[model samples]
Target: MAPENSNTEEVVVGEEVGRVRLITLNRPRQLNVISSQVVSLVAGFLEKWEKDDDAHLIIIKAVGRAFSAGGDLKMFYAGKTDDSCLEVVYRMYWLCYHIHTYKKTAVALVNGIAMGGGAAMAVPLKFTVVTEKTIFAVPEATIGLHTDCSFSYILPRLPGHLGEYLALTGARLNGKEMIAIGLATHFVPSEKLDELEKRLVSLNSGDEVAIKAVIEEFSLEVQPDEESIVHKLSIINKCFGEESVEEIIKSFEAEASREGNAWIASVLKGLKRSSPTGLKITLRSIREGRKQTLSECLKKEFRLTMNQLRSVISGDVYEGIRALNIDKDNSPKWNPASLNEVSSEKVDRVFQPFEAELELNIPPEGDAYRWSGKYENSVYPTLKGKQ
Candidate 1:
């Protein structure tokens, strides 16, 4: 049944075929952004399926070139000043929490672009399958937002300082890199996705072994490309492992001066151009995320995000949206524009606890390390190429 009081026609569609319940994001024209309406539609179906015994497993995909671009920026632009906007964000956070600790087996078919909130949806699923056409990123820093959607918990668990590097610079990864970084479970060609989906839906049991067996039948062995950033793990660790953002930038500059590494140069450019306050807070968030539980990370992120929207100390987020989406001018006038002008104290202010009324009411229940420890010691049969 379609959701009522909606202008769109079940833009978020959920249908059951045998034991599989497939949910698709249908807003292709909008790049399938996770708008509030989409959230309501998707969340409603998910809640319904949670009680349906016939829905043995769930598969989420999109009917476009992008699984989802991110949260709807236009909505943010319109409600930047309103407290009600946080209501949608809170809903998204809870949905993410539900996805992480979901009872049923979950699979995400990430065939195209999945950035920011989109990455959050797929990264926590029990099975994440990607295609050559897949592109993944969490470019929140570029828009003066720290990575949210429980990404803080996910990123720090990535190998070495790669998480810190990505959080600060807003780097991107292809499907191959995603597997290398353990973000994706399997890689199948775009052409083979339909066959894989058919096989997955045919499975009557939600048993992990049975599902893995079905997925393994269609998984491919693909190597990361020559120019992959993950290939520069050593350089990434050396620079991003620094104690402070200043030290990291200096390290990058030193490397750029000697080796003239184009990648390092580009990273430096991105960091320097991004909102200074954003870079500082993101670095802190990732560092703290390494120590915190999934629930803790989400709570902290909710506080920080609310702070950004509220603009208690700075309004870079609003400026970023205006520059990037509304004005289309591609220039954000960041307050305290330069990194030198942003102090550690200001960064600390964002992480301070919110009042009881403003705190994210997520239950303490979760499997914090559920996804982490599984892939660390054992390499998947198909992921041998990644080894």
Candidate 2:
């Protein structure tokens, strides 16, 4: 365990078990939230392991109820006024990109809450193991932030318009649901994770197929529950597939009016309550992500994040955090208070490219790794009246 500070708490612990390099997120009290220190430490470890010939496999897990909640919001809150936080964001995204294109086989054992930045860590790995305790979501929109951390690339590849629904609504998915959606590769019961880890270490070899077989031995055959939102794919595609956020909400409104579905009503309520500008920005990013490669998506997202942090268009992120975390009040007075007030030009401004020197320095496409998952084409039925 490497101590990050004078507090004697090792925020990230790394050790080798045979040929396996294990990384444990050790901040239980903080729900293993990713801080600048955490990103730097993990990135450093990955860089070292990538070169070490003895390291054949990498496994990332956490010590608390949360694998990782997300990026350190308090850090962002503290560095709200200056470009001081950009370095962390740059490094975090680069870390994510490195993991995405990692040379060695990698696995993420997610047994707890994995949201936002946490999801980024797990989803890009070659294999991800989840347990019943795993909870996943990309809920940046709810906090007046666009869905980021390379999700713009990942989400659009899910079957149908599920990505749009997730990005806009911040819907939470359990372990079973995650596997069903191809977001996770295996589902092991929480009780068997330790045994599975030991078995993995005993192999002492970096054969991908062998590693998968061992994981499968401990994994369970599970399915999404009857009440899971995944079952509502047709409705989701019908509603979220719309070109504009306003039109998407309108589709939901139409569905709610026609069927009076409690689910649709709840979705409508959630969308209405979220930041109008965030919804617009997130929707555009997800759509653009459909054609862009992983690197392109990250670059685009970096611009959006920087713009939001710089308050290029508005300071809704700060307001959102202040309302949710600082004041503990649910009410966030979003600028351009309604959807109609959020103009297309304003949305475009958020996605505008930064100058050459200020942009994220991602490695070229040929050097970066591409996801091997079967990316289903995101096609949706045309809305009745809208194009």
Candidate 3:
């Protein structure tokens, strides 16, 4: 329970209803951004509910038009000069891991905009219910940060080279596209969400089958629209499959010249507008993610995040935030200015393992930490394994 206040300023609100434990992101004005406070509250609720015998299911939803816009970049910007911000990143990633390995079933009702940390919270759950109003993206690279919040593990597991494409380009995926790509488990119309919630609470059981059955009743068979970038899988696979960021841009450039595709041109422009160093680092992170376990990927991402924030290689993140958020200039002056100038050595240094004490300490996965989503089985195949 939150402390009583005249303002009722709770960023997150939680309650136990029947057999269901519901967590709501309450800070609509802030887009329910994942501040340190938000992380602490949500993590505490999840930990508490996991131990509650009366709690059979967990449902996470948010008020307003955005599920979460991402972590508080302004907060990050404020703490950029010191290690003060790293604690939040550490705790947030830990929360992400806990959700991934949670014992009981959890569902995210992402009925609005879900980006970065928002998408992080939803996608890893046992079931992610998206609606027509849902808009999802991992646009971190544009801000000179890598896609994170266990996305390193989740994204690489997406079908074809879709993971790389999304990570590199910060592409947006609609509800139908999310379902098609296995990022979402169900698509329920926005209007039925309330009824669906009521039905779920009535179940009062964590039985995956029972819960899934109820959800399926309202779930629609949705396909990505004809104009969805999801349909460009073949081209996405070919272009993003290249060994390097340079190669990827080159491939897109070649494709654009040959086909004169507006989409391809847009991709190329996005690449050109992003920090060269960010593109390189993000590309490597997603590639490494393919071979690493979820735990390993989180650790590596922790390192990358720390290094980026600390400006081990460059201060592109700061510049990016300044240009986009603070200054609203929409023009960032990347240190290396171009992809060719971002050396392999600098990128490697960013990924180097942190000191044992500095590393993220993730708990070992329990048997209950398994994924059974309809699309995940085919897209992810296995969650365990080093190779």
| lDDT, each prediction | 0.82, 0.85, 0.86
- How far residue 329's Cα lies from its native spot in candidate 3, in Å, is 0.9
Candidates 1 and 3: which is better by TM-score? 3
- After TM-score superposition, the amount by which residue 59's alpha carbon in candidate 2 deviates from its true location, in angstroms, is 0.4
What tens-digit string does per-residue lDDT give for candidate 2 at 1-387? 222232337888888877989888888899999998899888878888887899999988888799999988888888788766776777777777788888889889999999998889998898999999999999899888999999999999999999999999998999999999999999999999988988888888789999999999999899999989989898899999998998999898988877536778887888899998888999999999999988789889988987898788888888888888888798999997998998998998888887764566666555333321111111111221221
- Write down the TM-score of every candidate: 0.90, 0.92, 0.92
- Runs in model 1 deviating more than 4 A are 1-8, 366-387
Model 3 C-alpha lDDT per residue in residues 183-261, reported as the tens digit of each score: 9999999999989988988888899999999999999999999978888888889899999998998898887877536
RMSD of 1: 9.3
- Residue pairs in clash, model 1: none
Taking the tens digit of each residue's C-alpha lDDT, what string does model 1 give over 66-88?
98998998888788656656667
Tell me, what's the RMSD of every candidate?
9.3, 8.3, 7.2
lDDT at residue 133 of model 3 (Cα atoms): 97
Off by over 4 Å in 2: 1-8, 365-387
lDDT of 1 at 307: 86
